[model samples]
Target: MLEVSAAREIVLRHAKRLKADFTALMSSSLGQVIAADVASDVDSPPFDKSLMDGYAVRAADVSPTAELTVVEEIPAGKMPTKTVGPGEAVRLFTGAPIPPGADAVVMREKTDSPSADRVVIREVPTAGQFILRQATEMKVGETVIPAGTVLTPATFGLLASVGKTTVPAYPQPKVAVVATGDELVEPNRRPKPGQIRNSNGPMLTAQVALAGGLPRYIGIATDREDVLRSYIAEGLEIANVLILAGGVSAGDFDLVPKVLKDCGVTAHFHHVKMKPGKPLLFGTKGDKLVFGLPGNPVSSFVGFELFVKPALRVMGGHIDPPTATQKLTLSEPFAANNNRPTYHPAKRDGDGVRGLKWFGSPDLRAMLDADAFLVLPPGEVNYAAGAVVEVLPINRTAS
Candidate 1:
């Protein structure tokens, strides 16, 4: 059995970053990694401005008994006519440029005679108040964001603030999916006797997209060795990775292993000891990466979350993909052998996580409602309630 860390090394070692491409805008490049460091061309806010709507006066001009004449009014878009001097002041609004020689701003609330013509100071004003200095937000020639950073919505706004209209980001990976099974039916069609719907293909495709990859749905394949081989070959020709669902188990009718072996592919490992996806298989055929997931729906979900997400991250130019793990108390008790690690879909309630009722790998409905998976490590005794367990977030919202 392949350990989880060993499998991760094998998968990430083969990860190859896609070529850099130009994106229309920063928002369009969400989850894409930056290829180079981005620097601000000019200092943000460019000039000193006022942060409040008040009267800009010279420090000496403001006094408890002095009166000043308003020479000019400066709005946001206009500039001041002359520098402020003794016995002179300017009316300023928010975001307006602070006129030269004006050392302080007196709030309108502190002045008397609410007319706009002239005002008498009822209170002494502090120096250099309400002025936002230039380059306070960002400096010129400084790296705003380093390479390999994921472009989120906040990052996109920051990029725009630095006058970046277009950006160069790592290209999104393209994945081709191949679902193998003879008894599989389409989702829209009702399944007859002894037939099940082919959901792994669409499910895996959606997972690929959710992980920031471009999914190329290649449809279903028959159980025949020749048919599976042809589909695998086609998928390999077009996509960076080939994800083949089903046909890796010990069943005599499972022809995926035979077809891969016939194609001169080197099978890295055939099975893992993890629950819900023990029959997972990973290998390499020439320069193409391949993964054969279990037939069950929940098994496929688990396999993709653990095995495929990291590879997709590296291939998208991220040095290391992000993973969310937390320690949470179990709400109920459960029993299992310590030989193999177990991952059960769980829901977070209050301060603990509760294991949902599931029917093993075939239960997709139960898995859909789960926010995370409670990971029970190998070689443990009975897990009683209130025991702390490591939780790995499966749903993207939590992550």
Candidate 2:
């Protein structure tokens, strides 16, 4: 069996990066990756603007108890018409451009308007105070955002600030999810005595979507060789990444690996040295990647986090994807399982991690309330309640 890190390296080495495509800067592009660098056409704030609603005055013009004449009133979005000369000030609102020859601003609370045109300044003003200088955020021709950046709401706003109505982004990978088992039935149907509802299909589809990939469900295939072969072929034809759950383990009905080989996929690795997902299979056919995950829910989730998530991120043009490990202290004692590296579902409780009530790999309920997976490396016997350990946060995407 391959180690977890080795398996990840093998998978990523075989996964090819997808081509870039231009997309409109819309709500749908929030999680997409940027393909090229975006530069600003104009300086942010464009001019010397006021950060507060105050009077723009020259520092040398204001005395300890001097009353300066208000030359002009500048509201937001409007330019100042008059300059502040000696013993003069401009009444400006927040975000308004500062008048020429003004170097400082005094808050309205510090001064009283004895009359509409005349204002009494109570405090001496300092130069360059309360002013957002031109190009303070970004200068013209400066790269506001670089390639491989994940498009968040703030990223979109930055693009809009640079006048980018249409963004150049990497295309989301189309992922085909296939669940194979004779005892699996659709979620809407009542399962027979010997059958169970297919949870892996929906779970994988949701994972794919959450990782910024377009998921296509290719339905379930029975244990029959021909049936599984047909479904695998369809998935390969429709998706850049084909994920098959079940039929990869060394069972009598295990046929996905052979079927994938027949469909021209070259096997990269077969088994991983991790609990719940040791029977993982990774392969590639041409430019398309393939993964055969274990049938158990927890196994599938772990496999996706360890291998598939990084591959998807790389394909989508992310420069440095997130690693599935974080340093966290355990809130309670944890007994290590044999010698295999175990990823057990746990909750992040007030700066520490606590194990959830898990009933092995098939217990989907155990992970429902879990925010992370506590990683126990091999050879660990037992860790005390306060022992520090590595954790993998669940359902979190890399920025």
- Which residue pairs show backbone clashes in model 2? none
> How close to the true structure is residue 212 of candidate 1, measured as C-alpha lDDT?
84
lDDT of 2 by residue, 1-399 (tens): 898988898888877778888899887777898889999999998999998898999998888778989999999989888879998999999999999999999998899999999999989988998999999999999998988888888898898889998878888889999999999999999999999999999999999988878899999999998899899999999999999999899989999999899889999999999987999999998899999999998899989889988899888877775455789999998886646888889999999998888988899899889989988777755889999989988874433
* Clashing residue pairs, backbone N/CA/C < 3 A, model 1: none
Models 1 onward score TM values of 0.92, 0.95
Using TM-score, give the best candidate's number. Answer: 2
Which segments of candidate 2 are over 4 A away from where they belong?
396-399
